[model samples]
Target: MVDENQLRQWGTKVVDIEKQALENLYQYIDSSEFAQACQLILQCTGKVIVMGMGKSGHIGNKISATLASTGTPAFFVHPGEASHGDLGVLSENDIVLAISNSGEASEILTLIPVIKRMGLPLISVTGKPESSMAKLAQLHLCIEVPEEACPLGLAPTSSTTATLVMGDALAVALLQARGFTQDDFALSHPGGSLGRKLLLKVSDVMHKGDELPSVKHDICITEALYEISKKGLGMTAVVDSNNTLVGIFTDGDLRRVIDADVNLRTTSIADVMTQGCVTITENILAAEALKVMDTKSINGLVVINEQQQPVGALNMLDMVKAGVI
Candidate 1:
């Protein structure tokens, strides 16, 4: 039978070893070479072309993606493919970032001549500071780890983790240097939830025109209830004779009237409707609208124009459907 305690110990040991590896990474990050790399990327007008072999290639791909999304345009190019005519992608204005744990991947070394011929600055990321690839490059970012988390010292674990963290550090530092904002991030990820929360506006999700539930202030409670039911928004805007918003009546108001023993058939909505209720503009972000609803402890809001006319309406369900809740 498998020993459960042994398995737990092994897992804990791996985590501890990897943690130490990351701790060793701090010294490299504080080095002058790291600062030089950031400056090189910032000065380059072209994309960062990252190249690597095997496991390093996987980490390189993710690093490239992070750089691109964080405002530093970059993409990965396998060193093996570069030797097979993929080198055509290289431009004189581009910068090459090569990743190799040993800094001696033959595939990457083979492309050094062509990259040098193009006059592109090369940045190397490796565990060996004295290795050929590191010595050949204009700048080197060291990712040397004391030991591998793999018990056999063959599979890359701590090394890859350190490389990933280094790439993240570069991307974030550049992002801050460029003054990147949430709006800029939203532009790159418009389909994501954060994008929706930042970009979606009340006009994009609120029910407008005939879909809006509204009734005159003189309408009886029973009539207002029918409008609310027909609209399916659980509430109706109470408007004056000139079609300007006066108040709002909701299902909660109906319950209150019932508890008070009021005759819904005879009572006018204006008598029970909440006056000067919370309202929003169509141009405001849905996220901001959510904040307003939360602060007021309300479930819905009436959208009004400059003239105080009811233009649109939305509720918590609408916010949910819009992915803004």
Candidate 2:
């Protein structure tokens, strides 16, 4: 069994302590060393390598990902592995970001001499400015907090969160400096939802050429129904004798005609079809088309040309195929 009161208090205490740690980080942002550190990273010709051990290593990997996605070109390397062979990844043109709370991680300390020998720029993020990690590095970002969020004052919660946020700030600053756009973000994250939204186009998913269901305004209701079945879009465009769009017929209209006992063989599309149907231009984005369909409570749209003639068609299924859904 556990004390509910203690659990609740502990949760709140962690938030308060971590909040203060972040506030402290803000105060250190304007320090001259941060600017110098950013300049060193910005000027590096090779990739930025982030290295850490234990809890710091987890935060460092996320920082490395952020840097890479945001345009700084970075990757994480475990400090302990560098002693084996991973140190070969580092070169004279590269820069290293090493994070250690105590700034005295033995694995990291062991690599200091080799890193110096390679003459690679090293930046340190730590809680102790006086630790060996800070003394040996080219730049130091002190992330010290008076106490841990844990009641035991031993957990790495607040310190690790602060370091992670500081890493995010650095990555975003570089991203903005380089004017990295959403299009650029899509390049690396092509399998994700955001990439799908930015990379997909209307032409990639539209039913064009012979695949489009189309009927002239004077065409009989039976002919329109046949086109709908052949095209499998559940809808067909009704064009005038002059080859201009005038109306549309869908499954809903078929149901209404059946309920009215209208003769499908005798009734013309011009009379039974719904006039002034919702339409989308061929040039519009598929995302915009999706919004239009949603707002209009329609499942499909007739893609019309500049001459107001039916050129193509698409349904919600097309959006799914294009990855817009």
**Considering every candidate listed, which one attains the maximal lDDT?**
1
Model 2 Cα displacement at 37 (Å)? 2.4
For candidate 2, report its TM-score. 0.88
Q: Give Cα distance to truth, residue 63, candidate 2, Å.
A: 1.0
For all candidates in order, the CA lDDT equals 0.95, 0.89
TM-score (all chains, Cα) for each model: 0.96, 0.88
Local accuracy of candidate 1 as per-residue lDDT tens digits, 1-325:
8799999999999999999999999999999999899999999999999998999999999999999998999999998988989889888899999999999999999999888888999999999999999999999999999999998999999999999999999999999999999999988888889999999999999999999999999989999999999999999999999999999999988899999999989999999999999999999999999999899999999999999999999999998999886
185-204: candidate 2 lDDT, tens digit per residue: 98888788788777766666
Mark the regions of model 1 whose C-alpha exceeds 4 Å error after superposition. Answer: none
